[model samples]
Target: MTKPTLADLTAFSAVATHRSFRRAADALGVSRSSLSHAMLALERDLGVRLLNRTTRSVSPTEAGEALLARLAPVLRDLDDALDAVADARGNPSGTLRINANESAARLLLKTVVPLFLKRFPSMALDLVAEGRLVDIVERGFDAGVRLGESVPRDMVAVRISDDLRFVVVAAPSYLSGRTPLITPDDLRNHDCIRQRLPSGKRYRWEFRKHGEEMAIDVPGVLTLDHNGLMVEAASDGLGLAYVPESTARDWLDDGRLVTVLEDWCPFIPGLCLYYPGHRHVPAGLRAFIDVLREVNH
Candidate 1:
């Protein structure tokens, strides 16, 4: 008797549900040719034609339909049983992969993880501190953190932080000898520490006042992609930096970094935990999101 493999079952199930090799291939993140080949091998092993393939479409044969009908619920129960085990543990146990910008990740590290671990000590968090917006589904991330405004419409987002403001801050030593910059336009002459986006482009500094918004491509001598690095450089008097007010709170209180253009900087949306819609959200993820909501509340 030939033993059934999980891969064979998964491939069969995907194709059965989608009814098309191309659609199944797209969902499984495999080439159409690979899916077709797998089906062929599966048919060969069983000595039966499972699918009636045509130039335009593919449909399961009667035997294949019967097999799928018997297997689907069993597979579903297997998955549910595994999930139940994870849920029965009460505390999540597994590696949670997340993609986020440097700033958002820092915020999460400071506030979210402590509480998360308190509730679910066994869960391991792997954070990729990146500046690029990654496709969470394609990249295989459980979730991603981003600024609320930056999250796509198709994604479901939960606000993790209150509205945050970006402020222009400079080391007291750097501002000592320079002319005081009261307006956003004054940034044109000053050396600002710029943030280079992951797309190999400079991030424009946006300012708004009295309902008027403007994006300024400020000239700068220092540029970095990491927000923490930019903060350090600004603290060392490299140049004025546009940073989140939350991050500069310590520097501002201690008189290390002076806030400039305070009126121009206004509160925008804050950090959000976002993920794809329609996908089966794991129980672990559901619990984590609930924790986030409780903490935020």
Candidate 2:
């Protein structure tokens, strides 16, 4: 029995990931022939064909996929460990991948990231603005930001912002000739600006007051998917838009948009940073969480 070498595993991993010897060689900064020889040596030593190769392409065998499922993380951890040791001697340094909604990312960039970066100059932050839910760990993300209620129960979460409220508003010009909507029932007769979800269904306008809550299936002349676009269209006097109160505050203050049925607007859970409970969080993530606690506390 012979001991496996790091080079053997790395070449196999690279080829498995790239699915082409030429691409794998480019990624590993080696010649194609050298990479092919290394894999052949590895297969000879292991006495198994780990990869199925053809003239035009390369693919992993069944055993290769299982090996990849196990080794990919292990190799990644090995690389991370090396970086950690180097980082410990100098500064807290690593890329922090965070998935968040566009609004939260905007808020963090405006309010949180400046302070965090001033303190840890070496850290890199990749904040992805995505509306859909993501499996942070499986997707190689350090953490995710979502509404408190939207966070998965299996993950640990820390509050980053206070409660949020949603408001229904329309541009002053658009409302000039239209009758004011005093109640949710009035919205049915108005040209509401509706938002479409990622799944292509129109978002239902919801309202609540005291102890009663209801969803209004209001008709609209225009529909959009992005909140930023919805706000812009409403500001241009297209139609009424139901949006987060915080997002509409500036427009409302400027008198460009008028809030309607304020009493019916509901306060909901705000943004939270959530991560897997079972895994050891990286130093970069720990530092971010610490800053969140300090700021929100």
Candidate 3:
């Protein structure tokens, strides 16, 4: 009997972890047919039916589950060992996958991305902009970027920006005939543009004044998942939008959108780069973090 090679183990573990050949193939940057062939070959060599497949889903059999339980940790340790060697070389060269929200991605692109790339030309960055929070480790990402307060307590977080502020703004045309908004409650009577979270829940507008905080579920004619689109909607006279002030800066500066209720807007903790505390920091991630600190400072 021949021993299973590293490639075979990696393929099996990816499929087992995701429970979907298509997802595993995508993650591995391989074709679905190729992944299927690898798995079949692995099963043939092992002489066991390791996976139970159906039209809708795939799950590992008992033998496969046992194998997976052992392989995951071992693979992580092997990768760590390789990373240690790479670190010894004093140069970062590899793909650094990051999962970040739209706002964070925009902030990084504007502030640090160009400099970071110039400083580390050999390193590749894969930035996935998402509206929802994701488990970076499980998703095979090296790190994630999100508001400091939103980061998981178990992860190590590094501040990448100062406080962020939200603002309520609308085009002059939209507010021409409507009553001016004086308080948070006044938003109820206005045609506000709302944001829809990844969980399908609408984001409520939050306000703070003199230590008092209020969250309002503003009535809206349009709801969008992206802040840029929300700003555009407000600029087009669709409705008032409560968005990160940075997102609406250009429109506000150009007199296309006017801000209201500035005193009520709160400055929240800024975005942070976070990663699992237990894993060894790869050279690429370490270099990226250093660049982030340099640019932010």
Candidate 4:
């Protein structure tokens, strides 16, 4: 048994966290070959295979997962301690990674991002936007932004925006000949731009009014994954798009798109910035949260 250097252990954690040498190397600002060799040396020192590497992909072995589970908290504590010292000196400086769905990302970009960067000139933000809901802890993100209801129960959430509403919008040309749209069921008669969830399921158009609720798996000639794209399609008169009101706000205000079923689309919960409750919130993350509240209020 031999003691591995702190740097080697840190690199091992990064590789295990990402499950890809190239990704870990890029994040660590090292070459892939060097990272691979380092991982190999780490495994040899421990007398256990930590990662199962293939030509196409890499994954942590059972032992690697166990080590990572214990190592993550230790490394996080060290980071927090360092961040505290840095905070004592002045503005926090580090990269803050956030994973968010497209809608939430757009909201953050519009509201929190610019000010946070301007306020802390040394801080860097990596905002990854996609349709998928990822495990922020496992994926190595400082936080995640999603609608309040979608946040995992174990995490602490802070509201970043006002309550959001989803509305059905269409170009006037597309609405002209369509029958008066009233209820959720009426969508069947009109072409809609269907939204595809990251899980490969078509989103069921949900509506609530007068204590009645309905989820319609609306029919559509076109299916799109992103809300912004759906809004664009609807503006092109392709079909009705169900999207966040903010995403469609510009078009709605300029008369490029008109809303229908507004009564059925009542305000729901707003976007939230969430993170694991157990881990220490780094200085950069704390400062970032401050910016969110400042911009939000």
Candidate 5:
């Protein structure tokens, strides 16, 4: 057996992180063939297969998973140390990856993203918009943006937006001959457009009234995963949609969609930027946080 060089380890780490040779190569600014060769050499030296590669996808094997679990934190620490030095030299530069839902991404793009990029020209931001709550650390993200209540308690959360509210709305055409929705139970009689969560469960519509909270499992014929699509469906006269107030505002104001059960809608804590509490905050993340605070104010 031979000792693995730092390049070998780093390449292996990148491949394991992304589970794709091409993506890892792109991220590392190298050729896929070179990365594949490096992985082969690394595996030969270790005497164990680290990856299961097929024509369409790549994934870590048992040994690779073990190695990845150990390598991720150590590599992050090293990167942080380097970023710290860069910060001291007044040249903070690194990639800052963020996991956020569509609404959060929209909010950041509208308010904070431009300022943050202008302030930290050397830093690269990768914003992944997803519907599921993800493990930011495990996924190699610097942070995640989620609703305050949805953020993990173990992570440090910073408020990024003001309080948010949800609304149930439908186009006039759909509501024309339909029974009026006067209560939460009225949703049962109407054709609702439901949202599908990443976990494969349907998102139940939540409402609040006079200090009491209720979750309604509304039935619907169409199930969409994105909020934008839900709003579109509602506006197209397909069904009623329960979505964030911000998402439906334009449609509601223009009479493309009209709100229902507004009194039952509840104001909840807004989006937040959350990250691991134990690790050192990189300069890029710190800069982003500052911008978020500025925009929030």
Candidate 6:
């Protein structure tokens, strides 16, 4: 069998790591079609099928997974060695992958991402936006961003935002015919657009006032997974939604939606960018954190 080139090995690893050619290509700054062709050529040259591809998904075969198990650490070490040389010169250069929620990612794009890119033009970043809180270490990400309250205890977190509040909101049309929402208990008399947690459980609406706290499994026929979607549903008069106050601000301003039970909602912890405390922080990641601190401060 012909030996695979270094580029081939790295491309295969990237595809397997991302489980999609499109994402892998974006990470590598290549086109998906070219990446796909490279994988086919690499597999043919090695006389082994490394990837199982479908229209919607991709997975590494057993042989591919075994090769990746050994190859990944070697590639990571190679990157670190190269980055170390750059770091010595005070230049952080390498791919920095961050797994982040949509909200946090948006916040970073507005405040942190541009500055980091402009300052470290030689470096690259892959910010994967999703709602689920994933295991960043296992997923091969340099870091992850999430709400401070949701960050794992073991990781080192850099605060990116201040306290935030989640409020209950409904369209004025929906609220007009319903019983007055003076307290959390009155939510049971109306339809609530329930939020589905990442873990496949419905998020219980939480409320607190004075010394009393309540978690309500709100009544509703419709359930949505995203806060943005929940806010849209509430705006459409489908049902009431519990969402970030900032997310509902525009709708509230336009008279499409109005807040209820405002006395119950309280400010909670803000967003954070977190990483594994045990591993060596990549130079690019450290640089990014510095930028975060500078911007957020």
Best by TM-score: 3
Q: Total clashing residue pairs per candidate?
A: 0, 0, 0, 0, 0, 0
RMSD of each: 6.6, 5.5, 2.1, 2.8, 3.5, 4.0
As for candidate 2, its clashing pairs are none
Q: Write the per-residue lDDT of candidate 2 for residues 1-297, one digit (tens) a residue.
A: 466798889889989987889867755668999999998888888888889999998999998888878988998798779667745874568678889988889988987788788888889888888887766664557799999988999999998899998898889888887787888999988888898886678888988898998899888878888877777889998888999878888888998888888999989999999999877677778788888788777
Per-residue lDDT over 1-297 for candidate 6, one digit per residue giving the tens place of the 0 to 100 score: 889888989999999998989878876779999999999999899888999999999999999999999999989898778878888998887789999999989999999999999999989888999888877764668899998999999999998999999999999889786678888989998999999888899999999999899999999999999988999999999989999999989999999999999999999999989999977788999999999999977
Q: Which is the better candidate, 5 or 6, if ranked by lDDT?
A: 6
Tell me model 1's lDDT, rounded to 2 decimals: 0.83
Candidates arranged by TM-score, highest first = 3, 4, 5, 6, 2, 1
Clashing pairs in 1: none
* Model 4 Cα lDDT, one tens digit per residue, 216-281: 999987999888899999999999999999999999999999999999999998989999998888
lDDT of 3 by residue, 204-228 (tens): 8889999988999999777898889
Best by lDDT: 6
Could you arrange the candidates by lDDT from highest to lowest?
6, 4, 3, 5, 2, 1
- lDDT, candidate 4, residue 140? 73
Candidate 1 wrong stretches, greater than 4 Å = 1-4, 7-81, 84-95, 121-124
Q: Report clash pairs, candidate 5.
A: none
Error of 6 at 122 (Å): 0.9
* Per-model TM-score versus the true fold: 0.71, 0.75, 0.91, 0.87, 0.82, 0.76
